[model samples]
Target chain A: MFDILIRNGKVVDGTGARAFLGDVGITDGRIVAIGPELQQEGRRVVDASGLVIAPGFIDPHTHFDVQLLWDGAAKPALEHGITSIIPGNCSLSLAPLKADDRKTLIGMFQQIEELPPEAFTQAFDWTWEDFAGYRAAIEPALAVNVAPLVGHSVIRLWVMGADAQQRAARPDEIAAMQDLLRECLEAGAVGLSTSFVDVDENARPVPSRFAQFQELDALCAVLGEFGRMLQIVPEFYDTDITIARIDQLAELSLKHRIPTTLSPVFDNRQSPNNVPRTLARIEEQTARGARVWPQMQTRPIDISFSLLRPSLFFARLPGWIKVLRLPVPERMIALRDPATADRLVADVGEDGGERLMGRLVVRGGGEAPDHLVGRTLGEIAAERGEVPARALITLSLENDLSIGFLAANGGHDSTERIGPMLANPLVHIGASDGGAHLTSFSTYGDTGYLFSEFVRKSGALSLELAVRKITSDTAEIWGLKDRGLLKPGFAADVVVFDPQIIARGEERPAFDMPGGGMRYVRDSIGIDTVLVNGEVAWSKGSYSDSATGRVCELT
Target chain B: MALSLQRRFTTPEPDESLESLAARSLPDLPLDVAMEHIRGWNLHIFLMRRPRGLLLGGDVVFIEPPQT
Candidate 1:
C-alpha cells in the first residue's frame, strides 16, 4: 500500500516539461509511482485539485548552518517549499572548527551573518569538532535536508591555527589541509566553500582570502577525488575581477573535472556593463566544457537598518560604515561629536545626503514616533529644518538609536531588465542569503518572489521552467543525488501550491531568536502543503512534527 | 568562439609589499609611475581597505587602469 497518495494534481516533474494531470504515490520515503491515476490502498490521500505538484525547491546558496541546529525546519524556509538546502556558503561553517576558535568564528558570524553573539553562545551547545560529529548533532532533528559545504576558512583554522588568516600555508601545512578536506568530504560534505570578499568582525580578511591560488588548487584536488562541487564568493563589486575569478574557477573546473559556482552576480544600473561582461565570460567558460555557474538572486536589494549596528547598506559610504562599526557607547559619542557628524554628512556629497537618504522611509514597528514612522527621511528633514543626514542623527539620538529605516528598491530593482536575465539558462537563480542577514532583511522569500514577480508579472520565465530552475537545475549543479525530481525511486520531496497566488508575505520582525533577539521574516503565501521524504512537514499554513529530512547523500 | 581578453591583474606574492608588487607586475615602467598606476587601478586595495594598501597574498591587484 502507498504511504501517501497525492491524486488529481497537475504535476510539473521539474524536467522542464509541461504540466499534466497526474497521481503521485509515495511509500517508504520515495516516489514509488507517478502516472494519470493510481488504484492505491491504505494511505493518507491529499487532493491536490487546482494545485501544481512539483519537486520541492532546492536553495543552492545559504547560511542556514547555525539556524539548522535549533530550528531544524530552518523555519520559514521549509514553509516556503524548500525541502533541500546547501548551507555553509561564503567560507564559513561551524564544523571542523576547534573549541578554542569558537569565539573567533562567532565574531565572524556576527559580522557576516548579522547574528547576535548570543546566537552562538546561548542557542546550542558546542558538540562537534569534525564534520561527522556536526552531521550527527543536527541530522536527527532536521525537518529540511542539508547538503553542507565544509568551509575553507574552518579547515585552515583547524590545520594552521591562528596563522591561517595571517599568512600562506607551507607545503606540509597544505598537505595536512588536503587530508582534512578529504576526511570532511568522506563524512558527507557536499563540497568546499571559499570566499574572496568576506571579512571577520574586526575587518580582517577571512582565512580563505589568505590562501594563494595554489592552496585553493590543492583543495580542489581533494574535491576532484569525490567529484563534488566548489563554491566561492567572488569580488562581485568589480567586473574585471569577477571575470578573472570566473577564469580561475573555469581552469579549476577543467583540471579537477568538478563543478564550481560563484555567488551573487547582481545587476547594477550604475554599472550597466558589469553583469553583461561577467555573463559573457561565464558563457565563454561554459562553452570550453567547464562548468562555472553564476548565481543570481531574484529579489530587489531592499535593506532595513538603524544606526544601531554596522550595516552593509553603507558599504559604499566608507565613513558612515567606519563609525557605525564602533562599539555602542563609542558609536553614540562619535554620533554626538560635531566634527564626526559633519564629516559623515560631507561623505554623502554636496547635496547634504539628500540623494541617498531622501528616499529612505522610516520603518515602522520600532521606537520611531508614530507620526514619523511612514514618512521619508527627507520629508522629516524638511519639517525639522535640518539636512537629511543631520536629521537622521538627531532623530536617532532623540530615540536612543532605535529608529529603523528602509531603503527599498535600492538597486537591481528593474524587473524589465532583470526578467530576461533570470530567464537566462546560464544564470542559476539562488544567492538568497537565507538565514543570514537576519536583522537586516528577510532572505526567506526570493523563491516566492521569483514566481510572483518574474513568472506572473513579467512573463520572463514559464511556470514549468521556473520550477526547473530551482529544482533540477540546482540539484544537477550541486550533484545532489536522487532528489529534485518527481519520478519513481526519487526522494518524495514535493510541494503543492496554487500557481496564481504563490507569494511572500510582508517583512515583519519576529522575536523568535535565542534570548528573544529580533529578526525580520516573511511568511509564505499560497503554498497548500509540503512533504519531506513522504511525510507531511507543512500543510495548510501549519508545520507538523516530522523529522524525516536527511543529510543529502550526494551522487 | 574566440574568448575576448578582459583586464589584466596579478595576485601578490607571499609577504609582498605594494612597492614590490608594482615593480614585479609593471617592470617596463619607472618604479614611481608603476606604483602610481597600480594604486590608481585598484581602489579596492588603496582606498577601500583598512590600513589601506595592505597587500594580501590572494588580492587581485590590477596592473593597468580600467580598460576603455
Candidate 2:
C-alpha cells in the first residue's frame, strides 16, 4: 500500500512534456508509480481531477537562512508551492559564525537584506556557531526543503574575524578559508554565495568584496572538489561591470568545473542595452561549455518606503542616507535644521528632485493625509510653489514621517521584452528575494505572477514550459537530484492548482514577523494542495503541522 | 553567441597593486600609460571606492573604455 495517491490529474511532469491524465502513487516519501491507473491502495487519496499536477516550484534565490530558524516553511512561501528553497544568498548566511560576531552578522543581514532587528532579537534562540549546528536549528520545523548556500562573507568572518572586511586575506588565511568552505560543504551546504555590490550596515564593502581573485579561486577549488554551485551578486546596475562579472564567473566555472550563477540582471528602461548585453554574454559563455546561469525575476521593480525608515532610493544619496540613519529625534532635528535641510535639498541635484522624486505617488499607509494619498509629489510641490525635495522634506516633517511614498514602475516592467528573455533556455527564473526585502515590496507570489502575467497573459510561454521553467529546469540548474519530476522513484514534491485562476494575490501588509516586524506577503491563489516528499504540507488554503521537509542533498 | 561589443577588463592577481595590475593587463603600452588607462577606465575603483585606488583582490580592473 502507498502512503498517498493523487488520482485522475493532468500531470505535466515538470519535463516540458504534454500533460497526461494519470494517477500518481506515493510510498515511503517517493513517487512509486505514475500511470493511467495505479493498482496500489493509499492511506490518503486526493482526487485532483480538473487540476494541473506538476512538480513543486523551486525558488533558487532567497534569504530564508535566518527566517528558517523561526519559521521553517518561510510562510506563504510554502503555500505558494515552493517545495525547495536555496537560501543564504548575497553573501549573508547565519552559520559558520562565532557567537561573539552574532551582532555583526545580524547587523549585516539587517543592512543587506532589510530584515528588522526585532526578528533576530525576539525570534528563536540563536544556539549555533558552526554550519552543522545552524542546520540542526532549522531542520526540525521545516515544512519546505532547503539547500542552503554558505555565505562567503560569513566564511571570511569565521576565518579572519574583524579584519575580514578591512583587507585582503593572507595566504594562510586563504588556506584556512578553503578548509572552512570545505567543511561547510561537507556539512551539507549546497553551494557558496557571495556578493560584489552589497555593503554592510556602515556602508563599507562586505568582507567578500575584500577578497582577491586568488582567495576566491582557492575557495572555488574547494567547490570544485565538491562539485557544488557558486552564486554571486554582481554589480548589476552597471552594464560593463555586469558583463565583467559574467566573464569572471565564466572563467571560474571553466577553471573549477562547477556551475556559476549571477543574480538580478534587471531590465531597465534607462539602459535598454543592460539585460540584452548581459544575456548575450551569458549565451557566449554558455556556448563555451562554461555553465553560467543568470537569474531574473518576473515582477517589475516597485519600491514602497517612507521617511520613517531608510530606503534603497536614498542609497546613492550619502547625505540623505546619513540623515535617515539617525535616531528619530536626531533625524527630525536634522530635517528641521535650516543648514542641514539646505544641504540635503541641494544634494537632490540641480533640478531639486523635480526630475527624480517628482512623480513619487503618496502611497497611503500609516498617518498620511487623506487628500494626499494618490497625488504625486510633483503636483503637490508645484501647487506649493516649492521644489519637490524641499516640499518632500517639509511635508514628511509635518507628518512626522508617517506618510508612505511609492516609487512605482521603477524598471523591468515591460512584459513584451522580458517575456522572450525569460523564455530563453539559459535564463533561470529566480532572484525573487522572497524572504528578504520585507518593507520594500512583496516578493511572494512571483511564481504565481509567472502564471498570471507571462503564461496566461503574454502567451510567451505555454503552461507546460512555464511549469518546467520553475520546476525541472530550476532543479536541474541547481543540481537537486531525485526531484523536479513526477517519474517513479523521484521524491514526491508536487502541487495541484487551477491553471486559469492561478494568480498572485494582492500585496498587503502582514504583521506576522517577530515583534510586529511587518513584511508584505501575498496569499496563494488557486493553489489546491502542496506536498513535500509525499506529505501534504499545504492543502485547502491552510498549512499542515507535519514537518516533513529536510535538508536536500545536491547532486 | 559572440558579442558585438564587450569591455576589456582584468581581474587582479594576489597581492597585486593597481600599477602592477595595469602593467600586466595593458602590457602593450608603457608602464605609466597603461596605469593611466587602467585608472581612467575604472573610475568605479579610483573614484567611487573609499580609500580610492586601493585595488583589493577580486577587483575587476578595466583596461580600456567601451569601444562604442
Candidate 3:
C-alpha cells in the first residue's frame, strides 16, 4: 500500500515539461509511481483537484543556520513550499567554533544578517563545535531538508584562531584550512561558502575577506576532491570588481572542476550596464566550460523599518544607526538631543533628507495615527513645516518610537527590464535572503512573487519553466539530488498550489523571534499544501508536527 | 548549442608593483604615467578597498584606458 497518494492533479514535475493530469503515489517517503489514473490503495490521500502539484521549491540562498535549530520547518519557508534549503551562505554558519568563539560568531551573524542577540541566547542550546556536531544538533528537528554549506570564515576561524581576521594566512594555516574543509565536506556539507564583502559587528571585513587567493584556491581544491559546489558573495556594488570576482570563481571552477555560484546580481537603473556586463562575463565563462551561475532574487527591494531597532535602511547613516542600535533610553536621549539631531539632519544631505527620506511612506505601526498611515514623510513634513529627517524623528517620538516607515522599490522594480534578465538561461533564480533579514523584509515570498509577477502577470516565463527554475534548476545548481523532481524513485517533496491566485500575502509585523523582536512576514497566499519527503508538512493553512527532513548528503 | 561572447583580460604578473606591472602591460607609457593611469582606470581596487592598491593574484587589473 502507498503511504500517500496525491490524486487528480496537474503535475508539472519540475522538468520544464508540459503539465498533465496525473496521480502520484508515495511509499516509504519516495514517489513510487506517477501517471494518470494510478490504481493504488493509500493510507492517506490528498485531494489536489484544481491545484497544481509540482516538486517542492528549493531555496538556494538562505541564512536559516541559527533559526533551524529552534524552528526546524524554518517556519513560513516550509509553509511557502520550500522543502529543501541551502543555508550557511556568504561565509557564516553555526559550526566548527570553539565555545569562546560563540560571542564573536554571534556578533558576525547579528551584524551581517541583522539577527537580534536574543536569537542566539534565548533559543536552543549551542552544543556543537564541528560540522558533524552541528548537523547532529539540528538533524532530529528538521522538517525542511537542509543541504548546508560550511562557511569559509568559520573554517578560517577554526584554523587560524585570532589571526584569521588580522591578515592573510601562513602556508601551514592554509594547509590546515584545506584539511578542515575536507573534514567538513566529509561531514555532509554540500559546498564551501565565502564572502568578499561582508563585515563583522565592528564594521571590519569578515575573516573570509582576509584570505588571499592562494588560501581560497587550497580550499577549492579540497572541494574538488568531493566534486562539491562553492558559493561566494562578491563586492556587488562595483560591476568591475564583481566581474573580477566572477572571473576568479570561473578560474576556481575550471581548475577544481566544481560548480560555483554567487548571489544578488541586482538590476540597477543607475548603472544600466552593470547586470548586463556581469551576465556577459558569466556567459563568457560558461563558454569556456566553467559553471558560474549568478543568483538573482525575483522580488523587488523594499525595505520597511521602525525606530525600535537598528535596520539596514539606516546602515550608511552612522549617527542614526548608532542611535537606533542603542537601548530605548539611550536612543531616546540621542533623538531628543538637539545637537545630535542637527548632526543627523546634516548627514541626511543639504536638502535636509528631502531627497532621501522624503518619499518614505509612514507605515502605521504600534501607536501611530491612522491618518498618517499611508502618507509620505515629505507630505507630512511639509505640513509640520519641518525637514523630513527632523519630522521623522519627531513623529517617531510622538508614537513612543513605534512608527514604521517603508522605502519601496529602491531598485529592481522595472518589470520590463528585469523580466528578460530573469528569463535569461544563465540566471539562477534565487537569493531570497530568508531567515536573515527577518525584520527588514519578507524573504519567504520571493518564490511566490516569481510566480505571481513573472509567470502569471508578465509572461516572462511559462509556469512550467518557472517551476523548473526554482526546483530542478536550483537543485542542479546546489547539487541537491532526488529532491527537486517528482518522478518515481524520487523524494516526494511537493507543493499543491492554485496557479492563478499564487502570490505573497500582506507584509505584516510578527513578534515571534526568540527575543520580543518583530519581523515583517508575508504569508503564502495560494499554496494549498506542502510535502517534505512524502509526508504532509503543511496542509490547509496549518502545519503538521512532522520532522521527516534530514541532512542532505552530497556524493 | 550557441554560446555567448565576452571580453577576455589578464591580471598583472606576480610580485610586480602596480607601476611596473602597468608599465609592462601598457608598454607605450612611462612608469609613473602608467601607474597613474592604472590607478585611475581601476578605482574600485586602488581607492575603494582598504590598504589601497594591494593587488591580489586574481585581480582584474585593467590595461586599457576608458572606452567612453
DockQ of each: 0.68, 0.57, 0.22
Candidates 1 and 3 compared by TM-score, better number:
1
Candidate 1 structure lDDT = 0.91
lDDT of 2 by residue, A52-144 (tens): 889999999999887888887889899998999999999889989999898899889889888998888888888889999999999999999
Give the chain B TM-score achieved by candidate 1: 0.92
Report the Cα RMSD per candidate. Answer: 3.9, 4.7, 4.9
Model 2's C-alpha root-mean-square deviation from the true structure amounts to: 4.7
lDDT per prediction? 0.91, 0.88, 0.87
Model 2 misplaced regions, further than 4 Å:
A39-41, A305-398, B1-5, B13-37, B51-54
Per-candidate iRMS values, in order, are 0.9, 2.4, 4.7
TM-score of chain A of each: 0.90, 0.88, 0.89
Worst 10 residues of 3 chain A by lDDT: A361-370
Residue A18, model 2: Cα distance from true site in angstroms: 0.6
Number of the predicted model whose lDDT against the real structure is largest: 1
Docking class of 3: incorrect
Candidate 1 C-alpha lDDT tens digits along A1-555: 899999899999999999999899999999999989888753799999999999999999999898888989999999999999999999999989999999999999999889888878788888889999999989999999999999999999999999998999999999999999999999999999999998999999999999999999999999999999999999899888898899999999999999999998999899998888988988998999999999999999976789898888788998998999999999999999999999998898898889989988887657888789768999999998989988998899888899999999878898998999988999999999989888778899888999999999989999999999999999999988999999999999999998999999888778888899878889999899999999999999999999999999899
User: Where does candidate 2 clash, by residue pair?
Assistant: A211-B57, A212-B57, A212-B58, A213-B58
Error of 1 at A240 (Å): 0.6
Candidate 2 lDDT tens digits, B4-47? 56777777766678778877788889999988888888887898
Predicted structure 3, TM vs. truth: 0.86
Ranking by lDDT: 1, 2, 3
